[model samples]
Target: MEGDLGWWAVPLAVLGGAIRVSTPILFVSLGETLTERSGRINLGLEGTLVFGAMAGYATAVMTGNPWAGVLVAALAGAVFGLVHGLICSMAKVNDIAIGIAMMLLGTGLAFYFGKPFIQPAAPDLPSIPFGWWSDVPQVQAALNVNVLFLAGIAAALVLHWGLRATKPGLILRVVGDSTDAARAMGLRPAVIRTMATALGGAFAGVGGAYLSLFYPGSWNEGISSGQGLMAVALVIFARWQPLNCFWAALLFGGAGALGPALQSVGVTQGYYLFYAAPYVLTLGVLIATSSPNRALAGAPGELSITK
Candidate 1:
């Protein structure tokens, strides 16, 4: 019984870890999934998140309202997405290249504006009180999970259903599957793609807002450690489905939290390797899901990258 209990502990810890870490990944992956479903890829998500974090934090500090910060961050992300959309939709600029450029611009802008608020401790957002029902410390700790994490999962499920069972979802999928088909259906592919990109950016921005306001209250140059970019690959691993993105992001988040958890237990030698777990897992999932022949098992057919 003792040995069996020991075996079960690892999974429990992993579950706890997942709850703690999945929020950001959930946001970024969902955003990416939406963009990709419309046959456009916004590789600049990393930058969008970082800048949004800065903007959100600054706004919260100025307005004394965390929700305001999130709203502004969404707007900021929308602007970035709008730029990416215009560039990709108008000129011959590749989506990937534009995404990279947008990332650099976003990061640079964040650093420039974030300098003033470096020392000011802004008001933090309150957490949902799930811990109220738990007596055990461990259970309480798990229950005291971020509301954003739960919201992320809900968003994914809802978005998944929306994309599959709703008319708008069908239209977006048609646009993603074939521009010619979209035109035949009298839908503007570029417009659909642009809207999808903007929506994705908004979600990514909110995810970034969560990072700055909730998890690590306060900001610095090193606030985000690449969770944004890794989420890009996460969407692929999730097969571009919002619900799948939730599970995949949770798995990645759990992998990410393992290193710190191990260190707390006096194991510190493999810290770097453990920290790399999410990226490695993401790459592995990508490899397993991707193919050299035939389209990605579930990828939208008209997507330029997968096809």
Candidate 2:
């Protein structure tokens, strides 16, 4: 029984950690997938994530309602995305550069405005206690599933279906594939792109809310841990597919859980290296998938980097 316990614990811990840690990535990557499918890249989601964390935390602190906080975070994220979309819509402006500027601006504003709410306690998002059937304490703790994670999964399914079958999805794909074609079809590419970007930003904000209002369950400058940035690469690694994003997020989440999972079982050597696993995996995926002669399969034709 003792030997069996040792063998099973760490994997179970990682299983739980993967679900917990992957929620943010799932949201952010889904959002980025939407934006990229519309032929725009918003590198500023990192800033949006941080700002959303601050706004969500602050709102929850004031309203005493975690749902309200999630709403506010989504709104704030939309505003950031709108700004990026508007700026990029202008002629002679570079989308990537504008995205970077927005990232810095969003982060700066979050830091500046969020200073006062740092120490306040806020209500946290509720979780579903799926592990109630388990007698093991670790199993119970690991099975405490957040509602947002479930929502994200539902979203992935909806997006995958919508993109493949819906009219709006067709329009987005058309615009992304060729701006000239969209213009010929009387569809304003800029308007479509802007809307997509804003919607994407709102998704990212919700991801941020999950971080500050649930997992880490605190408002602080260090809350994001670059999940926002990592999401961009995740979207690419998933080959721009929404369902693929879900699996990639879990993989990344499991990678993220490596150090802590090992530690839970008394294996803590090279702890920092384990923590770095996600980034390393990301870099490796990018290198393997990258092509010098062409854009990635399924990548939008009008995307700046691809061009």
Candidate 3:
């Protein structure tokens, strides 16, 4: 019985850690999934997340309502996405270069705007209660999950079904897989790509909003720690499927939690190394999945990177 119990404990602990760590990744991964599915890559998602975090936290502090902060953040994100889409679509700029520019612009904007609200307190979102169901502390800890976490899973499921089972999803996939095919079918590739990028940005903004308004309230320049950038790599690992994004996010989250989990038990010798686990895992997955000899399976053929 002792051995059996011990074997189960590791998996449960990992599950808990996955949920705790996956929330931000889930949002970013989902957003990127949508963007990539439409045959365009928005590298500026990192900027969108940071700017959204600052905008959301500042609005919540000023208005005393968390929902208002969410709305404002979405708007800010959408505007940023529009700019990225417009510039890329215009044929005057390169997508990768534009993405890098957007990242710098976003960080600068967040730092500049976040200067004034650095000290104000804001209303934060509340977590759901699951602690009452279990008497054991470990069980309770594992079960106590975030509402956003569940919502993200639900969104992924819905998106998965929509992409495979719905007409609009079919259109998006067609455009992503082959712009020539989409054009033959009379679908406007640029319009669809623009909309997809905007929607992706909005979702990324919400992820940022979650970071500032809930996890670590009170805005600072260093609020986000590169979850946004990693999310791009995650989408490729997820194969642009929303359901896969959910699982991939959880795995990334678990890798991220490893460092802190070790620190909790007085094992801090390689703290920085453990902290790099997520990136290492991400790189590993990318190398494993990305092969020059064979094309990325299920990749949208029309995507610039894939071709």
Candidate 4:
């Protein structure tokens, strides 16, 4: 009835929008965090992300099942990750450069094949009406959280725990810390890294699926809007902690929601500028956190940034 809560609506909308907007980044950052944790980095996840979006949308359209699309997306992402991992495992290979190439390749493939699905409508993933109790339409709208966002949160918690308490996590950390040490322990660093990278890619694919199956729900080449590449900065900002990635995703999500939130309240003065909030926030964080004398506290030792 009375959705007119005046100024209060802005923050409420932002909160809802933040949860909605954060899902993809949350998934991508979690995936990238795992990749980095395993002592490898994939700049190509942006590509994987786009490809996943295309695959998921196409599948959903064909099957009339949103879940099927998500599954296919994850599988497709794993393939991309597998390729990236294999290439980077080679001696003297630069992960960043390879990542860039993969990004272009993924985008190219999506654009070419995604043409047919451009106009087709697909079933969207469902959302939880958390604000079902609210009488205000804005509150109800804001509280309609997606299931993937919940999954992302659960995933973050599980990842954080798994990293600290699991045997495989220990081995991964050992490999990530030093190839020599891992070798001495009779572990295969290349293989481990490759697997980690692939799993990470799967995570990224789910993120892409969220895009096409949910918020801004559709198949498009530009759906990702660089959220995949920003995974690196997000991971860095989160200090490689999975739980932190969750919070960071929300922060980024809220920043990205500023424009729409303000516009809903008839504040369009700096609409375009508000849309850039996430980027500005990212740049500010990077600049502020950067240091010439010391390395990031918890960065994997084998990661190039730490070196």
Residue range 35-105, candidate 3, lDDT tens digits: 78888888888999999999999999989998888889888888888888888888756777888898889
Q: Write the per-residue lDDT of candidate 2 for residues 214-238, one digit (tens) a residue.
A: 9889988888888999999999889
Arrange candidates by TM-score, highest first: which order?
4, 2, 1, 3
* lDDT for residue 203 in candidate 1, whole number 0-100: 91
Give me candidate 1's TM-score against the actual structure.
Answer: 0.92
For model 3, what is the alpha-carbon lDDT of residue 66? 88
Q: List where candidate 2 sits over 4 angstroms from the true fold.
A: 1-4, 292-295
For model 4, what is the alpha-carbon lDDT of residue 32? Answer: 92
Q: What's each prediction's TM-score?
A: 0.92, 0.97, 0.92, 0.98
Error of 1 at 11 (Å): 4.8
Q: Rank the candidates by lDDT, best first.
A: 2, 4, 3, 1
- Candidate 1 accuracy as lDDT: 0.83
Q: Write the per-residue lDDT of candidate 1 for residues 7-39, one digit (tens) a residue.
A: 444555566777767887789889888889899
Using TM-score as the measure, name the better of candidate 3 and candidate 4. 4
Q: Which stretches of candidate 4 lie over 4 Å from their true place?
A: 1-3
How high is the CA lDDT of each candidate model?
0.83, 0.92, 0.83, 0.91
Best by TM-score: 4
Write the residue-wise lDDT of candidate 4 on 1-307 in tens digits: 1247867878987999899899999999999988998898889999999999999999999999999999999999999999999999999999899999999999999999999999999999998999889788888999998999999999999998999999998998998889899999999999999999999999999999999999899988789999998777999989899999999999999999988888887888977899999999988887787787543878888986666
Pairwise lDDT winner, candidates 2 and 3: 2
